[model samples]
Target chain A: MSLLSLRDQLRSGSVTPSGLLDDLAGKIVSRDPEIGAYLSHDLAAAKAEAASVDLSLPLGGIPIAIKDNMNVLGQPCTCGSKFLSENYTSPYDATVIRKLRAAGAIPFGRLNMDEFAMGSATENSALQITRNPHDLDRIPGGSSGGSAAAVASGTAFAALGSDTGGSIRQPASHCGIVGLKPSYGRVSRFGLVAFASSLDQIGPMTQTVEDAALLLGAIAGYDPQDSTSLDRPVPDYLATLNDGVKGLKIGLPKEYFGDGIDPGVRELVMAAANKLAAAGAELVEISLPHTEYAVATYYVIAPAEASSNLSRFDGIRYGHRAANPADLLDLYRRSREEGFGPEVKRRIILGTYVLSSGYHDAYYTKAQKVRTLIRRDFETAFETVDAVLSPVAPSTARKLGESAHDPLREYLSDIFTLAANLAGNCAISVPCGKVGQLPVGVQILGPHFGEAKLLQIAKAVEG
Target chain B: MSKPHIDVRYVANLARLELNEAEVAEFQGQLDAILGYVETISLLDVSGIEPTAYPSPVFDRMRDDEPHESLPLAAVLQNAPDQAQNQIRVPKVVADA
Candidate 1:
């Protein structure tokens, strides 16, 4: 059942919350083996949460899937890596999970993701490979691949996914769902395992725009725990969501529509833009000249932060210790080498080189300066245009193993989406159309704290 | 302009990760390509622009200095790979006599 229909049914007493849990449990047993969407789940716990839920709450009895990176008290937060799986279990709940529980939502399952939310496809998971629901042969884009696949496969009502560089949006595009990457600092990152502290934002992945709005409304607010979390108040995302895009000027940055974009994907995204224009939104051509620099800048910055963040897993205080090590340094080296995958190791080396003493000025500092330029490009464009529209990814979901051999090609795939993270703005992907058997995603970007306008534009494009 | 040649072994040491001969060779080639691509940033003049370490406009957030419950020792050490007497244990950094 759809999330809305389930909510309606539960409220009207036509379908009990236990009935919903039973149905979802059955669906998981049948569909999960094929899709590999969940890393861990407990049906009994879900049923218990369902039984005690207060019906008066906004999200009463709703089952929400959590990405493995977020700590949810007593659950295994493996982060799809063997290293974390070896020793770690979350000792406390993430701020978002607490919010969900307060709103009467059952935090049901831990969804699969790229190991430590690193890869462009779910194939990077050391634990298991998550296949796209639409076509099992193809990938569900990552690092939020399993979250999107779970929602697409009807096993999850809604799921949380983190976006560093299009992890949420690209996967949602691939799986034909709605995914939002709220403005940087819009959501607390307290219990989330940091990938790139500056760029990562946790957002909702759901089957519909309204569900995305509902989930976002529940989680987004000021939290003292996260230093980066915004102090500003969160507006009712559902309130202005239905407000049409009449008279709103949506910009199509010339950089995003150029060569390398699949003709089919471009055609579908352009169709979406045209539909929004037809619904009274004025389409304007805008230039974000620094768009091309986004990927290069992100590669430097994200890894630099990740190197610092991931250094915590040193086999000392917590996580995967090497047995009978000769010395402390040897223990750290061997444990991490055994724990992290190739993609992760590659980024760490690159990050370490960039941040190392002699080269710091040329790489890390220079990239940060260029990042400022990228942010300015968006700020300059948003002056005349209320929101920006672009293709979420260059193409639809590619076949599994296609990106495995070539890492740079995978990084290039995130070209369109990385700038939003660099700029610290709100962006969302909505299923606009399809290319062949694959789904296409149209991205709507708004100024910082512009989620109301962003979701409204997404709703405007959404059928 | 000449492309940068990464010393993969040196970088691996810096990252505190142990890599064998095959891994070093593989990383050297991949890092060269990635760094070559990232070299584009050097072409632009960013002398006047300030670096954005954190994307948000907000800075130096201050909170009330009130005592709050801390994570219990058991909870903090729950994920420890090695534990004894409520403390995490690690290999000795000092050489044994």
Candidate 2:
């Protein structure tokens, strides 16, 4: 059953909260070993809470798995790296975790992700490679692979994921689920381990658009903890979600639907766009001329921020410390080298060089100027269209280890969805149709803080 | 494979990461490709445009500087790899210097 139906069952006394947990637990026991969705689950604490949870709360008794980056007090917040896994107990609840608990949802388990949310595939996880639930040999789209996998496989009703450069949406596309990357400051980032401070946003991965709305409603808000968080009201996302997309002009960016896109995935996305147009929405062609520069800008900006942010893990205060360093410099170097994965090291190096004195203007500063252009492209497109539609990625889930040989190939897959992060706009990935055994997702983008209209259009596609 | 453009050893040193010979060679190749791709941004005419450090308009959001209760020292220290006398213990920098 979907989250709403499950909610109805809980309220109607058709099934008790404990009974629901048992069913979810049974699924976890049966499926999690194969899927590798969870890093750790607190069944004892979850069952204990199920007994006394306040059913009056909006998300009462709903099980929500968390991507490992967000701190949930005592729960492990391993950003899928050996450093955080070996050290760092969350000292406090992230603002979203506090909100989820208040809304009566169980923040049940820690799902695996790319190390510090860096890679597109969960293979970057120091612990395990999360498999796509649909086909075990394929990768669950990542850095939030486990979050998408958990929800896709029914171990959790929904999950929370952080998107920097399509970390949430691409995984959702690969897993064939609903993933929303809320506007850049739509949700608090206090406890989310910083990947790219400017580009990261916490969002939902769910079975349906309505569930995404419910999950977003529970967590989205302004928080003083995250200085970048906008001081804006989060609307009741469900209020207009079911209203449908009648008369809404959905723009299809020509850049996204190009010859480079896999023909099978393009057909599915265009078919879904046709479905929305048939349902009273107008489909229009829009130009985002700066689209080609988005990936380059994101690579520079995200890594620059990451290099600055990750400098905090210096082995003294928190995370893994090197054993018997010859000196402080040696400690910092050895600890970071031992702690981080190869992808992380590569990004840190790239970021450091980009921001270094001689190269800063030529790379980082230049990238930022291009970022303004990319954002302007979205602004121009939104002037003529209510929302923009496109394929979430060029292709469906590739086989495990397919992208391992070449890192650039993996980065290229993010070309379609990376611009939304650059633009700081809200976007969603909804399953449109199937491509063979894998699922293809269609992406819908709205202007900043246009999640209500975004979810509405996503629901029309879901229908 | 094409020749690398930047000194990866210098960048790795700046990043505070120790890279072996093999990792340096691998990263050099990968970084060259990535830098080559991102170099496309330099072709655009952004002469008059301002660089966007933050995507959003809001900046320097300030709260009153007031004293508030902080996390208990024990809780903060829980994750420390090495500790002594309620403080994080690290290698002797002065002695090494």
Candidate 3:
């Protein structure tokens, strides 16, 4: 059932949150073994929470899946890695989880992810890889792959997913759902497992733009725990969704459509643009010339930040620890080696190399400079247009093992989506069309804190 | 000018990862290929542009320091590999000291 339909039923008391939880549990029992979307299921606790939910609230006991990277008190947040496998249970609900519970949303389960939220595909997960619900042979995108697949497969009304690079959008694109990465500081990141500190923001993946807006409204606001959370008043996202997109200036970046984008996906994106044009929105051809540098810039900046953030996991404090250690260095080595997956290790090494004393100027500093140019490119483009339009990914979901042989090919899959994260802008991936049954996502990007406007535009396009 | 060879031992030590010989050899090939592609950024004329460290111009959204409630100690230790005295236990570290 659509999340909107579920919400309506939930609000009218036709379906109690407990009943919904039972139904979800049944679905998980039958389907999750094959899909592997869930890392841990708390059916009894979830049912109890659901039973106690006050139906008077907005969410009203909607079943919601949270990505494993986000702390849900008492849940095993493995982050799809062995490093924390049996190491830590969050001491408190993440800011988003608390808000979700406050709005009467039932916490269903913790979903799988790329280890440390560091991969573009769920294949990097040390645990079972999450499969695309639509095509089991293909992968759901990462690092929020499990959340996307769960929502796509009707496991939840909406699922919370974190986006450091293209995690949320790419997975949403692969799963054919609506995923939004709100402006970086718009959502509090107090309890999120940090990947790239500055780039990471938790957002929602849902079957509809309206649901995304509803969830975004509940989870977004200032938090004292998160030093970077924006202190602005949270806007009424649902109220803004109905605003028509007439004369809305949509910028089409020349770079997004170039070279590697698949022909079928491009056709669908252009068709979506044409449909928007037909709906009275004006399309402006724009140039974000520095777009090509986004991938390189993102790799450097994300890794540099990741290297620092991940240092806390040195077989100490919290999370995974090594067995009987002969020495401290051995403990550190074994704990990290056992905990992290290959991709996470690769990123850490790359990041450490870039930040090392001698190489900082050439790699980290240069990449930061490039990042400035990338942000400038967006700033200049935003001046001429209200929002930007692009493809969420260069192509539809590839087979599970297709890009595994070449990591660069895997990284390049995020090319179109990375710029938004790098620019710290809000972007959404809305299913534009299907390519012989595979879904293609048309990405819509808006200025910082323009999530409401972006959702409205996406809703218009959806209509 | 040639691309610098990434010292495998240095990379492994920095990441605190133990790489077997086979894995190291495999990673060397993969890293070289990946770096070759990433090296394209060096070709761009980024001369005067200030490196953009963050996308948004805003900085430091600090909150007031206040005592906040924490989850029960038992609940926090539910998934811990090893714990003692309500604190996480790790091997004695000499390097950090």
Candidate 4:
């Protein structure tokens, strides 16, 4: 059930939170063995926790699944990596978890993700790869694959997923659901396990735009703990969500529509745009000229930030420790080598290389400058249009193992979604339609802090 | 394979990760390819453009110097690989002469 509908039932006393948990438990037992969306779920703990939550609150009685990266107190925050998978338990609630609890939502289940939310697909997860529910053999796009799958498979009322580059939206697209990446600072990142510190934002991945809005509202706000969170008031996203795009200008970036997009994918995205146009949204031919550099810029910047952020996982404090190390250095080296998966190690190395002396200017600084250009492209486009629309990914979910082994191939798949993260703009992926039973989403990009208008446009195109 | 641009051994050492010989060779090739792809930024003239370190660029965020309750000591030590006397224990850093 959609979280809103479940919320309605709870409000009317038509159903109890315990009853909803049982229904979700039954669904997971039947479906998750094949989906592999959950890393762990504690029904007893969840029910116990939910018993105290006020039923009159906004998200009261809603059991939202959380991506494994966010620290929900006492829950396993594995981040799909061996480092934390073994014995690490969250010492405190992440800011998001606290806010959700305050709003009376029960955060249930640890959804699987790429190791440290680094990979484009869950294949890089050290624990287990979550498969797409649509086709069991194909990958659910990641690093929010588990969240997307759980929500889509009806196992979750809604789920929270973090978007570093295309993590949330791409996975939601592949799983045929609604995924949102709010403007950087629109949502607090204090509790999210850092992937790319500057690029990562925790957002909602749900089955509908209405649910995304509800989840975003409960979670979006400035937290004193997160210095990057904006100080401005978070407007009610639901207030204008149903407002049709009667005369809003939506841009169609020509660069996105160019070669390399699958014909089937292009047709579906265009059809969705037509729906928006029919609803009085002007589809202007916009040019994000620097769009070509988004993936490359993101790869350099994200990895650079990730390498620095992930350096905290040395053997000393709370993560994996190697046995009988010869010295302190050996302990640090061996523990990381043993704990991190290959993709993670590769990124750390790449990040170290770029940030290393003499190479920093040529790579990291250059990527940041290119990032300015990318942001400028959006700034320029938004001046003329209310929002920008494009395909969420180049294609639908690929069969597992198809691009799993090739890092470059996987990185290239994030082309369409990286610019929003780079620009720190708000964006969402609403399922447009499916291509041969596999789903794709039409991405709607909004100016920074423009989520209210963005969700409004998303609702119009949702049809 | 063509000559690699990055010294994988040096970078891995800097990252404090110990990769075996086969893993090193495999990563060397992949990193070189990734580096080559990321080199596309060179085509654009980024001169005179200020680099963006953070997306929103909010600066000087400070909180009052207020004391608050800290995490319980037991919970803090619970996840430690090795802990003794409420402290995280690690190998000795000083080498005996």
The estimated TM-scores of all candidates read 0.98, 0.98, 0.96, 0.98
| Steric clash pairs (candidate 1) | none
lDDT, candidate 4, A1-463, per-residue tens: 6777888899998999988888898889998999999999999999998787788999998898999999998889999999999999998899989999989999999999999998877988899979998999999999999999998888888999999998999999999999999999988888788889889999999888988899999999988888899988888888888889988898999999999999999999999999999998888999999998998999899999989999999988888999999999999999999999999999999999899999899899999999999999999998999999999999989988887457998898899999999999999999999989999899999999999999999998885
Tell how far residue B32 is off in model 3, in angstroms: 1.9
Model 2 residue A6 lDDT score:
80
Docking verdict class for candidate 3: medium
DockQ winner, 2 or 3: 2
lDDT of 2 at A193: 87
Q: Could you give candidate 1's per-residue lDDT for residues A1-463 as a string of tens digits? A: 5566778878999988788778878888999999999999988878877888987687888899999999998889999998898778889999999999998888988999999999989888999999999999999999999999999999999999999999999999999999999999999999999999999999999999999998998899989999889888889888998899999999999999999999999999999999998999999999999988999999999989999999998888777887788888899899999989888899999999999998899999999999999999999999999999999999999999986667888899999899999999999999998888899999999999999989989998996
Query: Model 4 Cα displacement at A121 (Å)?
Result: 1.6
Docking class of 1: high
Model 2 residue B24 lDDT?
91
DockQ for every model comes to 0.83, 0.83, 0.59, 0.85
Instruction: Give the lowest summed-lDDT range of ten residues in model 4 chain A.
Output: A401-410
Worst 10 residues of 3 chain A by lDDT: A83-92
User: TM-score of each model's B chain?
Assistant: 0.89, 0.90, 0.81, 0.88
Worst 10 residues of 1 chain A by lDDT: A1-10
TM-score of chain A of each: 0.99, 0.98, 0.98, 0.99
Between candidates 2 and 4, name the one with more favorable DockQ: 4
Better of 2 and 4 by TM-score: 4
